[model samples]
Target: MLRYLSIIFCAATSFSIAAQGVVTLDSCRAMALGNNKEIKTAELKIKQAGYQRKEAAAAYLPSVDFEGAYTYNQKNLSLVDKDQLLPVKTFNPLTQNYEYELLVNPSTGQPVIVNGTPVPLQMALLPKDALTFNTHNVFAGAITVTQPIYMGGKIKAMNEITHFAQDLAISMHDSKVEDVIYNVDAAYWQVVSLKAKQRLAEGYVSLVESLDNDVKALVEQGVATRTTLLSVDVKLNEAQIALTKVNDGLVLSRMLLAQVCGMPINDQFTLADEDKETLAETTLRPATFNMDNVYAKRHDIHSLELAVKIFDQKAKVARSEMLPTIAAVGAYHAMNPNTYNGFANKFGFAFSVGAMVKIPIWHWGGLSNKYKAAVTEARMKQVELDDVREKVQLQVNQASFKYQEAYKTYDMTCKNLRVAEENLRMAQVAFKEGVSTSDEVLKAQTAWLAANSEKIDAEINVRLCDVYLSKVMGELKIY
Candidate 1:
């Protein structure tokens, strides 16, 4: 008993929520747009493109870099001894006296004499070693700044490409929004169509039931045969079955609509009732379309055009790679154990400024091939753009033709409905006056039901066609 009571309460709550208000087409569109993941992704892409543009622009600014390093050598650097000569005083035994001697010139290999006496000269070469790097720890640091003076227009091309990417992202976002709106409209109208059919099914069942009751009464009064009552019963049963199916279909259709609107699948809601006569009257009227403006407004066409521009910019960038680059460089360097001047354990600072040029001398034709590839890609993009334009024109023409056809069908069904209604009324009058059989009445009722169903289908088709036309023309307002 508790479980049953809980289920009943939940169902009542659902019904109360459903009865709060009707979900209009605009409301559904808003909900879908707010919750759709595709739209959110597109929005993120736009932000990403914005950052890319900034990154490309940053290439024009100066860049600063800092570097530091420390090292320990196994041994200090040393200079070996240099060859040299020195004069010496010596005693000559042949002279029997102490005398000063001159040193011999090493390169000339000749003895030197003083006062016409040949004196033996003695010389000695001294050996000395000097320590070049005595310190075990070395530290060096430098800060450098570089500014690009010329880059063969690569930066400009890249900036333009980023701009094109941003435009493409925005166009894609608009296209996604249009798609969401189209889906919502389709789901909303499907529910509306099913609801109309459900109502028609209910009315049909009621009609058959009333006829069955009248036939049973006449049979009991001996005014109608049992077979006539049995035939009415069969019609009533079939009509009830059809009503059941229609009701089930209407529930499912509503669920589908709710899902499309970003609502819970099981969430129940009513649709704002649209008057069929008003819809038919409004849609039956023909209006002229400006195809030229429609083509211009299409987001896909704009996106393709942007893609072509982006490709062209890429080609420019590729061509720029083959040209020379120029930049200005400035640096300040400081190091401990200053070894540049000598082996001194003191920190010293130095600064310098200069310009650099990098000319592409040889690359085995690689740069030329890359530029050619970029050009070919740009050409392909242009061809694709042309193809898209042609396709857009074809879509517009197809949608226009479909709309016209749907309107004609709706008009014909409306006339047929009127005829069917009149035929049913006449059949009922004849049956009451004993001129028509039960079978004739049943046939008339079936014809009326068929006509009603056809009219409903026709009306929905017209509405769908209108939506298609608007979407193809890029005039559907998603916001």
Candidate 2:
């Protein structure tokens, strides 16, 4: 049992040493960016857009394709049917046309006829086999190259659209980065705030415990009643309970911050600001901003502008379908049984080059309607962008005002905390001298806790306000 206990103790101690680290804000932001699903998806979208742009650009170049086929025929092709015979003819000088040489009978002075046809003196015979042609096996193939000469500017517009699409994807990625930074900053500050409160709670509990001991001493000396001791005991119990609650809250807040950093929810980690008494505290200064510059730098606005450009290009593509299209085509063809050379029993090759043109006469208003719809969609996107720009302007102004107000509140809380600290000190001194009631001491302690808590909140609020104002002004960046 001792050996087993030793092993467990060593493992826990090693884990503690390994888990110790001061995680900075920049580190958390980097981890979140690396682990975020949205950021990875946005990266893939940018790559996809890049490939699509390349595809569009390829339309400007010629495309080559090949097709081939083979077939079998049952019989050969023939131009003539069966054997044939021809009569021999002789040319006569006195006559203009050729005269057939007719066979004359010995007893008849004229010609001999068989079945009402004259008999020629000589005839030549052609066999059926000589008229047959071999065409049983056939093969054909062609390789064609087509290049677009003109398409009413559709190709150019498509390429432009893809380029803008890539830009849009990049802008969206920037927007997601800003969102991630905002979330990390919020969770990080929450943990810091909770840590400060936890420390405050511990201090208050200790102070109350010391007072309880002093009151017990008073009771034993016969200078204070049991009623006074009971009251002090009750306040001590309340302070202990409050400390317990703050510790539990701090644990949960740490869990939230860990989750936001893309770490395991149950993992143990420390924040850089957790040990510090102040949170996100820095010198405050008045600031001025340029709305035009903010609008220009905003990722959403840039994405919307890209959307408008893409829609306009789509309108052009729709209109291109209504205009004339032209292409240059060249091809090489090869066929068996060589028909180009008297249907010989061999393969023959041929090359051809030509241009094609298409003119759209009518489409029953279909193409026209599509183009009009695209134009309307582009216009709508433009109007939405304008509206969002105005809203962003208002949002920046509001956030700026809130940011300044947070600093002012912080100043007031600081002064109040000082006053509460002084009052608590004075009350404790008077109570020790037996000149003040225990009730006054309790009130002073309570006031001190409230003031300290408010100051912590004010400091955190200032940090939050700064984050939001930077977000609205498009100043939050990944770096």
Per-candidate TM-scores read 0.84, 0.85
Predicted structure 1: lDDT: 0.82
Which ranges of candidate 2 are over 4 A from the true structure? 1-20, 71-137, 283-288, 342-345
Q: Mind giving the per-residue lDDT tens digits that candidate 1 earns over 1-479? A: 24224434543443444458556677777666766778779989999999999999999999999999998978766554454455566777999887667657678866665787555566665544443456688889999999999998999999999999998998998898889889988898888888888889888988898788878888999999998888888888889888898888888887887777667888777776543543534444355667678768999998999999999999999999899999999999998888666768898889989999989889999999999999999999999988888888888888888889888888899999999999999999998898888788899999999998999899888888888888889988855
The TM-score of candidate 2 is: 0.85
CA deviation > 4 Å runs, candidate 1: 1-20, 72-130, 134-136, 274-290
Measured with C-alpha atoms, the lDDT of residue 80 in candidate 2 is: 75
| lDDT of each residue in 41-147, candidate 2, tens digit only | 98899899999999999999999999999989999988778888878788877897788988898897678998999899888787777777788998899999999
TM-score of 1: 0.84
